[model samples]
Target: MNSTNNRIVQTWIDDQLDLYNLAKQLGDTVWQEQIVQTLYNKEQHTQKRMQQDLWRVFDSINRKMLELFGQLKESSNSYEVRVLREQVWELKLQRIEIVKKINK
Candidate 1:
């Protein structure tokens, strides 16, 4: 992923963590039903956004893989192939993390 996307994902992860922590803290408080419901709605919205982001990442990775495969087919450069393989591995790892976060 590019630096901008990386930053955005990291920021989102941080925000989710903060929200989770807030929910835990509020669990002991005597908040009204409306306040709790609002927080729940916000959490749901965030979750949907995260899922969309993950799908976008997956789509980007798919396109990159396709491009790399085409390049590899056209050239016999071992170094370039190795680099592309490494990038695919990185993308797979990122996908795994995104899946885990979404499951949470």
Candidate 2:
């Protein structure tokens, strides 16, 4: 796996931890408002972090793909970068299914 994939996987795992912590905190009454506020803050932070990570990964991938194209010395029309962008989407779907199963 590439560094970008590694980071995305790691971040997804870390987000699971954050989700657990937020859920636990939300169960407290006295700190309910505080917990909500904290969750909101963390949610925003997580979103931004995830977005930045994705941009970095995609940019790096694009650069590497261009480099590969050049390395092959194949005509531009002959070379097509077959990027498997669906892997991440599939992983996300699997994660959601697992979470739903656990909830049930």
Q: Which residue runs does candidate 2 get wrong by more than 4 Å? A: 1-40, 74-104
TM-score of each: 0.54, 0.35
lDDT of each: 0.68, 0.54
lDDT of 2 by residue, 6-91 (tens): 67556765665676677677775445555555555764555555566555555665565556556445534432423322433444
Query: Which digits, one per residue and each the tens of the lDDT, describe model 1 over residues 1-104?
Result: 45655666567666755766675787834444444554557645555666787778777877887887787778678898888778878877877876776576
Q: What is candidate 2's CA lDDT for residue 59? A: 60
Who wins the TM-score comparison? 1
